[model samples]
Target: MSSRTYPAWFHRVRSLVQDRKARGQAFRYNDDELPTRPQDYDEDLSERPNDSGDSDQSSILSDISGNASSEKARYYAMKEQRNERKKQLRDRRTGQGSNQSDDEWSEETEVQKELEIEEEEIRPIKEALTEAQQSPEENSAPLKKLGGRLFRLWSTDHVKYCTFETAPKRYIEFYDPKEFRGFKTYPDGKIDGHIYMVSDDMCEIDNFTPPKNPSLNFVRLDGNGVCHCFEVQFFDNHHLTLKMPKDLVFHRQAISPPSEAPEVFTYYGICEKYSDKLYRAKQRKEAQGK
Candidate 1:
């Protein structure tokens, strides 16, 4: 029994020594032993750890190469994540990043428009009342006067409130002044029953007599510088000619009435009742049922 035990124990010790060599071979893989090309490793795994056929330990080298490649892949993945975060930040800066729906924005604009209309609702009625209260005196108040300028309201059987500006013969050339109101807003001024041409310039007054038409107090400017001189000319929107003075300039509702027209020796065309309705050439034609 002792002799048998001795051989068995000796065999076991030798086998242990060979197994250690196999373990050491498997662990021999280092950084340099891996196949540089994948094709080379695929061609043949020629060095298994336990094989005795000239084991080259290629599997250990392959494991080291795979670990390095895995580390590189993880780095690229982290870089991609960082780039995505940067792109998100860039999108936020431009106004392109919108969170609310378009309907909400449209509703906000509509509310702003409604508020503007509400703000202007009271103006028209106030303007109408103010005009209604403007009496003849208030409308004809003297604006500051300068030399070579005349201001006055013009009234006629055709149209009333036809305001005008006139240059008298004394100061300057016969130019039209702008401080006159037009036919629409001359307030209530009237000339009735007949036509009259009174002006400072007698020749200009005589040159404007109608064909066989009668007129009253037709003359030149007396000591007061009033020009009864007038002409019958067509105005805009008038059916017939307007009896405007040649020296007077009438704007199309442009000039304000002068303060001096009422103070002068204004000639009346001898009417039965005091007529307050002023006339324009067109309006007179309409009133005649023409």
Candidate 2:
């Protein structure tokens, strides 16, 4: 045994001091002095106290979540209100609920109602019409009351002048059968008639009769409050002449198909009668059948 006894503690202390000196002399980094790895520091980090900044961030996140939830709730609430209003409007229109009422009818609805009423009354179209439907009589009392008289007007009858260039025009003047339906004139110069004359100028003529002698008749007011007159001369039952301030003549031959022919134009004629209530006139010899 050596005279000097080495204790276990003495060896440990000596080694520690030697190790420190060796590190300092060699410029070596100690394990504690070196940067710690993030993985290695994880446990220690967990043990550390929380900071105010971290708590603040957590609170902000919570606040943002709360605000988002509140906004969603408000959005849904407004959507529900809009849906309810739409339901009420729909219900009212369908008459599903008496409690719900409409503010007013739209202008289009009012106009439709008016149109329906007019169609019902005027019946411009009727179902299942037939040729056998009573034809207007030559001398119906209604026709007489309306100042209607049948007449034939001819410009020329000679075959020598039967060409359109040389031949005179012809027309059979009479009232429309529909004219017997009804008529009314308003103060505003508005008129409603089953057989209304709508031309360059509007007027309603009940009748036209020639004076005993050729003379001008009194001026009369049309539905538009416009003035009009007629001149007439009776040559005989077979012949006559007529002049109207306005062209209101409707041709008998043209009545059924109706005419695209000039309904309004200056008309003068020398006409002959086939009979008292009917007449014959020729535009061209080619139109002899009419």
Candidate 3:
């Protein structure tokens, strides 16, 4: 039997189908081989500039040969265009585009503005703290006026010493002898201690025993049985303020002892007895103002 002649297109299609079958068989038998199908092949010959002629195969071959260099140049140009398009897509996806950069700048500006506003708000507080820490001379000016006066503790609590005298280089504290009831006292009912000027605003009162009760004492003593230093907060002829190490402040007022004072009067008792008198005086003053 004689083999029949077939058209060129028919031969080409037959060859492609056979090639696909061979690849599929090889992929099945060997895991490393890849299967390729006829449809997966890119064969759009009509789009090729050299394949536009339909006269004969020789004419198509001659056209391809004549435009080989131009075709290579065109291929390279298309590849570069594709690469540029891919780079632009990547920039947009990663927030590196022009609009995204402007957004980032705006966010940074907002943060900086917020920090400036916070700093401005705290400026006054910082200045006030600086003045309070640096102006010890202003606080010490009142210390000189503390000497040669009888000052009563402003509190109503009956402490061991309710009144004190600030003598030259000495501090003399004493309680009312009659107010002790049964408690014993020294012959003079006074305890003397040396006072040393430590700094512009600080002083040390040494060689004095604090009250046995912790609450009755004005300041805590140090580990060496010495008194803790005092910070003179404010002072005048009639009033004195001292700050303790533990940040406690105590006030004292100058008082004139009465000629006929009660024999058994305590600090609290005196305040209680005179409270009504103080209230009546205030009421009278308010009425006079009206």
Q: Which one wins on TM-score?
A: 2
**Which parts of model 2 have CA positions greater than 4 angstroms off?**
1-148, 155-172, 176-226, 244-290
- lDDT comparison, 1 vs 2, better candidate: 2
Q: Quickly count the clashes in candidate 1.
A: 27
Give per-residue CA lDDT, model 2, range 74-182, as digits (tens). 3333334333444544565577765543333333443443344323322311211111123332322221221234443322111111122111123334444455445
Query: Each candidate's lDDT (Cα)?
Result: 0.27, 0.31, 0.32
Error of 1 at 128 (Å): 37
Candidate 2 lDDT score relative to the true structure? 0.31
Q: How many residue pairs clash in model 2?
A: 0
List CA RMSD, all candidates. Answer: 45.0, 45.5, 40.1
Q: Candidate 3 regions off by >4 Å?
A: 1-174, 187-237, 247-280
User: Which residue pairs come into collision in candidate 3?
Assistant: none
Clashing pairs in 2: none
Best candidate, lDDT-wise? 3
Q: What tens digits encode model 1's per-residue C-alpha lDDT throughout 92-206?
A: 3455445533233243453443233323321332343244345342343332222122212122211222221111011111222233335222223211112222223222211
TM-score of each: 0.13, 0.21, 0.19
Which parts of model 1 have CA positions greater than 4 angstroms off?
1-228, 231-242, 249-290
Question: What order do you get sorting by lDDT, best first?
Answer: 3, 2, 1
